[model samples]
Target chain A: MKISKEEVEHIAKLARLEIDEKEKERFAHQLSDVLNHMEKLDQLDTEYVEPTSHILPIHNVFKGDEIKEVFPMADPLSNAPQKDHGHYRVPKIVE
Target chain B: MDYEAIIGLEVHTQLLTKSKIFCSCSTQFGAKPNQHTCPICLGMPGVLPVLNRDVVEFTIRTALATNCRIAPSNRFARKNYFYPDLPKGYQISQYELPLAMDGYIEIGSNETKKRIGITRIHMEEDAGKLIHGENLGHPDSSYVDFNRTGVPLMEIVSEPDIRAPEEAREYLLKLKAILEYIEVCDCNMEEGNLRCDANISVRPEGRREFGVKAELKNMNSFKNVQRALEYEIKRQVQTLEKGEEIVQETRLWDVNSERTISMRSKEEAHDYRYFPEPDLVPTVISEDWIEDVRSKLPELPDAKKERFVREYGIPEYDAGVLTSSRSLADYYEACVRLFPNPKIISNWVMGDILRELKDDERGISECPITPGHLTGMLRMIEDGRISGKIAKIVFEEMYRSGKMPDEVVKEKGLVQISDEGELLIFVDRVIEENPDMVEAYQKGKTKLFGYFIGEVMKASKGKANPALVNKFLKDRLDCNV
Candidate 1:
């Protein structure tokens, strides 16, 4: 369950982080601690215990097959950092 | 060169509940960024989570629809991850005991029923969407919209039983139909209602153990899911043939390029650091509650399809298509009850009505013609009040004016000309004018008889009853001529 230095560096890169050297060493220890704790499940007698995926037993939950309303586009771009009328605005490329 | 592609899908559907899984925020889509979020979803300090009862009920409904075995007791687990979209660093999801497991959905045509095994259906919260444009100069940083954070989502995983791209698409379509019938999720891919992430791998012919699998992401549509899987299967098989190992990685589906690019190594289930959520207790759902939900369950698609075939006497294919959506089946049955002809009702719903609705991007509810109007039109044809060709005109007028079929036919003066005496004069004139056509008809050229009949009907301004015209034309041409 221990995370090696190389593994921590790889995970950091995958997560797109610009971490310092000291932070990498620290995260290695923290991640290893978390994984070690999770590994405790392996010690339990789960031979007969089935892995659970959902919590309810109900099925066929549906609504009336009707298109209630048109696609709402009014508010998605209201709080955008930039906006051009109704769409989310971004910077132009042409000089 | 002798191998098959075995593919299976893991679909995550956001249930259309009125609130989040653990909070009271509205589960509505397309709101202002972060407007639906609160302390519980934001994972603020001292904010405890409570399970939404509706979400659990919805999960059970989906399990029963897919013929899954419901668990007597299940609990929530914290799937630990660090992402901006997920306000809680650890997402509350099902892990050790899910609500349902070991269900199967029948796909493909009736003659070739392929049973796709559903491994599990679990509940989780949706993460926020990433709006990638902040820090425009740097081209690295992206803004995150937390509006979708903590929305209730059910992740249904299927066993790797699919062997082709078409079967993969069929599985998704059938599952979406079931979801739509059961009224759990909207199943709208365009609005991000029903989304799929496919796990695919290729193996040597007749090999027992599975090969290194790659998880494909960002497939927005069912077609894209199928195409991306096909492309990945080819790429993986080629890499393995070149003696290169097919690494277990997470790949992004570049929809524009129609190829998969490796993103990172696939994480194992244990890597998520899953543990029981301390905020919520293990839910012990009662059998009485399950039975109550079951009693309220509507007739599912398969049973309805069978009934439509047996009771209505429609073909299996027509019944299948009609029962694809509950609304469509209801509309068809309503028309049938009024008209009492399954074949005619099927034709209208599957033909002009569906074509018109699809072309205009509308649904059955949006159609101008009501089921009553459609039945009235069929009745006109049945009673020989109007010809089938004229019924088409009446239908168009009905759609345009929102008028009843009888009113449209009356206003347009579209009544059939069934007057045998009046039609005999027109038939005599046609037979006298086209003597050669009559002679040709008598000489075993039966096909040309339709031409003469057409002339008679056209001469009568399309109001001539087709059956009477045929009888008059045959009598005048054969005996009198």
Candidate 2:
């Protein structure tokens, strides 16, 4: 397989995902298959093709710098799992 | 073997925008927690991020000022990371195609001027503030304030051309001055309006290849940037000398400990996984837009400094000091309009005015003495209305009470004693009181001439015209009149 088990584990850790050993094995095989299918594009000889950044022809979408009223929704931190003092509280992440 | 340090700086300065970059929320500092966040900045589902029009204009202004080539087209990208400060799982920034590239700012200490290459200047969104500990009585959890989140930032990356820590400082100072002159950033380091991080490496003096490097962060001031680089370079040199490889890592400048400490190792670091932002459209810049930004750019520091020297005939050093800040240059020019003596005005501004402001740690804008008062005081010296010594006293009282120079001089009786008859009375008293000095002066003790002058100046309470006193004393003492 192009994607090793350790590589799959590393990728999962970077995304902060939790998976058991069986799920890791399955993801390794699945990711390698997806990459192998994507590799078929390498056979195309289209060196002159212009790389595409956006599919749409639109550009320069900007809003004026003037301040407008903020969209009033429910309290911003109301849905947090833990909140205090008008702040969204998370686990301690000090340096 | 002597080791040379190679340093590169990544300076992030917050732009002075009326609203946040991607949203319409007010970008005011010190707002309530999460007060400035909207659905877009907070990364809510189904929300799209739109660019602020002024951010692009301001970025173009800086790019032109730094001689950077603005990209014909640019787009935002997502820098994926996980931190409490970043509400979104990824930060919207420019990755491969930044707005501008290949700029340079000149820095010099002494007479040696050098160009420090600016690699890129890209626009990005700032992260929120993370509060740890029980500072706000949230003891058990870390709190995040999104007030600063999504505020526009321009990250200027420098080429790895800095050879020393002091050069790094010079580069930051020049960049800060340029940004301020262009009226783009406030350039206030204390309030987090401007931030800097540096990456440094050390190699033997004549070696070509670079050594392992450590990234330094959390330097709150420019002085701290230089100090941190110095400490890290020394540490790396020692590590290399001890036959140990310098570990590649990120370090934090511990303020209290006065040294750089390891913040994270390479093994624990995760890739940013940058990808083009799908929600935002690419920004295309035409020649007209660049020209429009170029035309509106203000007079930068170097050009203004040169003009000061050429037009005002002041020394290069004096012009450099006067044009250090835009307001200060304006102050000097205003005084010159009224007084028309550049060297004299430069002396007062650089010596007395700057000293007074520095003691209180204030900018020239906050100074109480106006240009009218300054030129008014200087005019007294020119018009023979007050002595130079007394003008110093008048200037202080004027600054303290925010009074005009004429009012201060009148209230304190600080006018010059220039009249010949008014001077003769004090002169006669001095010669009478010191008969030995007078006789000795008649016997060719010409050195005692200064003694007579001192006594007369004291009797007149330091308001005597020195030129008149000299003429009167020479006539009286040389012939025993």
Candidate 3:
């Protein structure tokens, strides 16, 4: 399957990226090429193999339900673009 | 032509776990903003996430309670989206293969039982809260509180089986009761611990296909959910009747306006590129673990209701009301143990106690009147220590003062006047003062006997035993001769 220009534009919009027409066209072709290359794996007969969600062989990685000391407010808001009363401030987000 | 509303609810209940789903940050509510943030929850560079085992157990517990089929293995996925409240720009959730599926919850009363299918129950991490600054005269800025971020939540999606607003509300109440019964969630809608969003559509009667649906949000209570759905159903039916198309959208239920405003159109749909979370491994639940959780499960609402009707000889409706909450059920059982008259106890609890609790916005656990106090009052009525009318006064005092029934009776001097010597005086006085009524009774008016009985009770200040007053009045009036 090939990715279309509209699909590329849709993905860009969802990611909140403003892509020009030229960039949309270029990325459309490049992404389709990547998809076509990835599709070559479908030619192999792997029906007996189970579909894997993760690459690792490990499962059930968990920790007990207990609280640990939280990071101080200064550490997280330090990297935020805007700070307000120990909270991260950003442009207003409507529901 | 009548149109029917088709509704489905998506409920997100925050699990009562100690920590966040994938971090060790405390999951306590009402904390200062950003106080619960850790590197993993804040999405700091190169930090990995480990799932909280309690979250998984809670999900399985809920699944089993709702009669769901638990998947032997489940994996987490990253639902990529952009929101200021979500620091990682993606929420870790179960998709494609959820923790449980194909479950059902029965709503409605015994005679009209309706099964609402649960399509899936998936574990997810909640996003943080956004404190809007529009009210503060700053329309361009908002503050993000990360306290709720990464908190364990279960998104329970129901199939489109609800046919009316009442059914939708019933479905939610039943689900909430089950959750509270299992002690998995607090199910506090006002505090946002349990939030519900509804998908509603309208179709003509006898139509097989579903109409275009609009998702409704911001319904803070069960009443609001019913009202919002009613408004949406009317709006959709009107739109369809006018030969107009129903555009799919997400609508906000404005509490003040009592209307749904379109928030987002279909064109603005986000493509949440879902993929497996690389940091977290798959969860493998063994059969032994499922059975252990099953064995720990308490008797749910339906089974308890049945047992109540069978054992207590109460009506199904009474059983349902008493067993609606675990605390209320315990209260009923305690009263039954003391009084052993389940029907009368049910009447008092369901009638007077429930009304008082509702008026004060209190729950059974917070009720001032204890079960012993209530049953003690009923015992006074049973033994004729106090008339039923006088018991009401004592009950009110007991409820207000948290005192025992006998204590209230003693304080008020409201004991019954059941002795013949005490009641005979009042009967003779009533007969002497009401000569015209006696003449009327002798002339065969007959119902004037009730008048004499009323006068005797009134003359005794309502302390006269009603049965004794009746016998004395009949004898004095010569009605039995």
Candidate 4:
């Protein structure tokens, strides 16, 4: 499972990350090494065992469907990079 | 060349819980922009989310309604994507193992009943709404409203079993009805509580393999969904007919142009990279809880329709129409309970009541006439207090004024003319004014009896009891005097 430079660039575009030309090569190698190391676990044959999704055995943690106090506009809007009419503003997106 | 279309739908229905899926923010629609936001829903760092118990119960209710097998233990995963509306840059959804799977919904009516397989139903959180316009006081910019950011959604995926666009529409209708029947979702398309995305493909006739598929979005109503699929099917068949390979892509249905346009090609598809969420714990549902929810389930449409035919003695078609909505069925039953004449009640409900409601574009919940008022008018006709024609006028007045039928009848002086003395004057005048018709009737032209009845009814202004008028006219016209 070797990762190519072109594949790395494609993934970066999908993630909306801005990567320079030189960094693409280095990151591709690093990510490929990480993936290869994780592949070693596939050697074990444990077909009868059930897959685990969580490390802890805790389950069914929930709260009642009741409304609590909500934060005012000042709480979230204060952290926004650009705010307009009490909403978060971003670059125009078509489609 | 004849080609067959294979269609499947993915529906996202917003649950009608009081709070958000993972937070305590109110999940009400159309609130002021960002008025329902909190640190948890806003995706602030170091903020943790607690699951709402109602969301899980609602999901289980939906699964049981659709005949799905629930997973004893299910967990949520993070679907990685990048969009401005997604403040967390990822949506928490289910993957690999979902809440329910391998369920089926029976669609169509009568001889066309077909079972469409549902692949899975999973829980997820909704993204914020994006408002793009120049009127936001900033040209060439987009505004985001986080009021709907963390609303709970159930993604129901169906297998590709639909053979035509019409079947696809029927499948959606049945699915929506079931969701509303259980009161899990409001199923309002206008309010964005329910949305659908379709996957469509066309292959040569008698071929077992499927052709390249295209995903369609942006259909705001069920009618649009059918029209879009119809257009996409034709487009795919024409492309294949021209010896061109079909390109896999995602298309948006343009309502004004009535055509599907490509939004993104398969090359730009996202990987998603789903992984289990560590913030929330997995849900372990016990058998006792499942049985409890099952016992509390309401009578579904199919069972209710069957009972209406057996118990109420109404035809299957009338039962189908009456039981289409829960509120409408309740209204029909209430009228039947009071009137105790199933066929007559069915006629009034299916005929005049439905016609007036359709004209006004209103649903049964917004109907002006209550069950008691409607039965009151029927009782007037039954007891000979008002003629059938006069009852119609009373019904119209009651609908317009929201008054009781008795009140409308009394105010308009619409009592039937069943008394012999009151009707005798109009009957005598009608016989005397038409001497030629009277001679014809004496000459044994028996069909002229209808003409006399018409003349008498006209003179009485349609307030005469038809049965009494028939008897009175026959007795008078038969006499020599």
Candidate 5:
């Protein structure tokens, strides 16, 4: 299925990307190429082929249902661009 | 203009594996914004994806639990997209070939069992979480937390077979129960471990063709799932009645407004640009491998429910409730193994024990009173050492103080006053004071005989064995009054 230029522009807006008109046209073509490949599966004889959802035959995998240790905040906050004490410091959250 | 709503659910559950689906990054929730991530999950350049073996096993286990046929050869595809939280730009998911398919789960009470069809269960990696905030008169830009990115997820999609809101809730609950029973997923909605998106459409009665369906997202709980579906159904039915077209789109459930709002026009499957992944090879599951996994499968909820009914002589409803969780069922069976009275254990677990645990915000796994203690309490009641009411009081103490049932009974001096001679003395006093009730009892108002038993129990400080009190009160009242 071919995605129109206008649809590509609309999708780019929804995704919050600042794209030029040329890039939009390029993406439209690239996306259609990918979808065309996926569409090839439709031509295969799948009437007798079962769609697989999982690969293994196992079931009922669980932990011991015990509440374990909470995640340490220091580890995650260290990667943030800015931090105040242990909390992540972002741009002013409120006006 | 009679109409009916047909609903289906697509549930995405992160498997409880130690690592990510294709990397060694720990699959831990709530890590500092991105502490659990590595290069593979971060989508850094020069990285290759390695499929997690445990993920395949967990997915297979879920398939077996749902009675799905596992495909012998399955592979992953890259679902190409460009979202901020998706660091890789494209998510590796099963598209052309999934792991399992065509399973069904039965829901509703035994008298009205409805089979809900499961379409497929596919494995994928989770995207990161986006935290939205307020800033400068407009919604602030989002903060991406990669802690959840690349976590192994199983997306179980169901056929559009549900008809009502209650049935939808039941289907989710039963599916969650089965997942929990098999230990595939924690199924915790509060922690965002398991989430569901709903697809709903309405049709005129007896119509073979379906109306335009809306996909609802951002429902945080099962109640929200049902309510959102109900609201959408009403909205769609009203739109059709007005002779208007229902747009097929992705909608967000504004939980506060209790309505659905269009997030965006629905994207077709082609939008994903899915292709077979080149870095990984197709998984070939051998017959012996399938057999090995199958042999390790535990007795699932349905089988255990049936066993509880047949072996313990309990009602199907009670069996279902007790066997809803593996831990609860194990707890119940352990109590029976200690006491060997199915009816009595069922009553205790379903009635007093469950009530106490719920009041304390505890599950069976967190319950302080072990099966041994419960069985001991039941034994005391059966041996006439404590009245049923006193047993309840001791149970509360046992749960609160982590004391054994026998210890609590002894510490509280809650032994039953079963001495016939002692009960006779109390019965004499009741017969004298309530001469009117005695007269009424002698004059064939025999049901009023319970008044004497009540008085005797009160006189004995609620410790008098009820059966003994009843016998003494009846004999004394019959002869003297």
Candidate 6:
């Protein structure tokens, strides 16, 4: 149940995180410990239990298709670090 | 070596819902940039995403129309990717469980009906529009429009059942027509309401295994989709012939170049770590609810097309062209109700009306000439008030000026002259002028009869009743001979 260092590095890259070599090794060890502990639950046999993505008892929460109050464009643009006429500006993504 | 292309299509159509999928922001297009966005859609911290009830209902309608099996329970997953268009680090999409599955859309290709298997239809939130700085004179940065963010989209994925590029276009068109019939998506590709991507691979003829596949993007129109797939298949086959492997990557259809250019990124780089969304709960649809949605489904394109052929007795091709849109089909049916000759209505609609609409890139709903106006003009032709040729001119005027058929005919003075007394003058003038043609007709050059009819028609400015002109010209020419 040991996570490889390469696996940790790949995970970091997918999350857009830049980690040093030492951090990659440390993360691999720590993540493996966490997964191994979670894997210990395999001892329990609840064959009839329905696997669920969320443990919450609630389901099917929906809002009607009614338009609420319209918010001003300036509010969100003000929070942006860089904006151009109510549009959020970011580095161009060519590809 | 010959290669057969195995193409699969992925289509994303924006649902015609009033509100955004997770927020109450208006889903109206062409608003000011970022005007329709809210905190939830902007991915602000500490906001719960609520599904819109209309989105699922629309999904049920679409799934039923496509003959898909609706999933009793489904949940949304977060697809993690970093792009400026997506305000959230991940897009909220369905991963493990989709809304519906195992559908087949039957399309007419090469005079045969082929059923393309639909793999799945999943609901997801649309990303925002990114206006690249280079295109807008702001060279280093891009502007983002969040107005399109959080728009509900149904991603319909088809199985690799399409064997040719033409079949792919047929499949896409059939799907668009179905969406239009259900009134779920606008299916306007130019406005980005309906977008398509294709996955194409070529294998040696009769090979059991599949060749490497490339994903094609940015095909904004159905024509471009077929062109892009054709170009991609050629590129792959050429690579295989050169003993070079076809690279597995995403390529974009360049409309200007008329070929697909490699996007220079491999699929491995876009590792979307998908996980179930914690905020939004699973949707569990009941049998009664599914039945209710199914009962509300409109008559889809295929059924309507078949009925048009059987009920109206029009050609299958005419029925297809007319039934391409729901409103157009309704227009045809309304015209038929007013005028019992369905074949004639089909000819006028498919020939003249659609030609005008296609030229202007307009829809039937936007047509100035309604079914009433069309049927009114057809009655004029039936009664010989206007000849068929003159009716075309009158119809054009009615379409252009949005006037009634009578008004156009009156304003343009396009009444057919069925009075033999009035047409006899033009007939005698033509026979008197064409002495050589007259002598030729007497000398058994009877093909000159068409020449006499033509001269009279020309002199009358195409207003003479063709039948009367023929009868009068024959009598004038024969009696003189």
Best by DockQ: 2
Q: List the residue pairs that clash in candidate 3.
A: none
Scored by TM-score, the top model is: 2
Over the stretch B1-481, how does candidate 6's per-residue lDDT look in tens digits? 8899999999999999999999999998888888888889999888888999999999989889988999999999999888888888889999999999999999873378788999999999999999989776579989999899999999999999999999998898889999989999999898899999999999999999999999999999889999999898889999999999998889999999998998776566677878889889999999999999888888888888889889989888888888888999999999999999999998888889889999998988999999889999999998999988898899889999999988888888888888878898888888788788789899899998898888888888889999888888777778876
DockQ, candidate 2, comes to 0.74
Q: lDDT per model, in order?
A: 0.82, 0.90, 0.90, 0.90, 0.82, 0.90
TM-score of chain A for the candidates in order shown: 0.68, 0.88, 0.87, 0.81, 0.68, 0.88
* Per-residue lDDT of model 1, residues B1-481, tens digit only: 6556777789999998887877777777777666666667767778877777788888889898999988887777989776656667788899978888999999876889989999999998888776555343324445566667878899999999998888999899899989998899989886799999888889889988888888888899888988998899889889988989988888888978888988653454236768877667667767897888888789999899999999989999999889988889999988988888899889999999999899998878898999999999998998999999999999889988899988888888999989888888888888889878778888888899889989988888888999999887777767854
Query: For all candidates, what are the clash counts?
Result: 24, 0, 0, 0, 20, 0
Ranked candidates, highest TM-score first:
2, 4, 3, 6, 5, 1
- DockQ, per model, reads 0.08, 0.74, 0.68, 0.68, 0.10, 0.69
List model 4 lDDT by residue over B262-324, tens digit each: 977444646888898989899989999999999999999888988999999999889988988
Q: Cα deviation of B421 in candidate 4 (Å)? A: 0.5
Regions of candidate 3 where Cα sits further than 4 Å from its true position: A19-22, A70-76, B135-137, B265-269, B479-481
DockQ category of candidate 4: medium
What shift in Å separates residue B326 of candidate 5 from its native position after superposition?
0.9
Q: Using TM-score as the measure, name the better of candidate 2 and candidate 4.
A: 2
Question: Which residue pairs of candidate 4 clash?
Answer: none
Expressed as tens digits, the lDDT of each residue in B1-481 for candidate 5 is 8999989999999899887777777776666667776667778788887778888888888888888989987888988866667877899999988999999999987789889999999999998865654421224445667778888899999999999988999999999999998788999876788899999999999999988898889888988988998899899999999999999888898889999998663464337768877667777777887888889999988889999999999999999999988999999999999999999899989998899888877889999899988888889888999988898798889888889887887888889987878877887887788888878888989888666777788888999889888777767766764
Off by over 4 Å in 6: A70-74, B109-111, B431-445, B475-481
lDDT by residue (tens digit), candidate 4, A1-95? 78899999889887888999899999989999999998998998879877776688789899899998855555568878898997899998776
Q: Please list, in the order the candidates appear, how each scores on TM-score for chain B only.
A: 0.93, 0.98, 0.96, 0.98, 0.94, 0.94
**Model 4: how far is B4 from its true place, Å?**
1.6
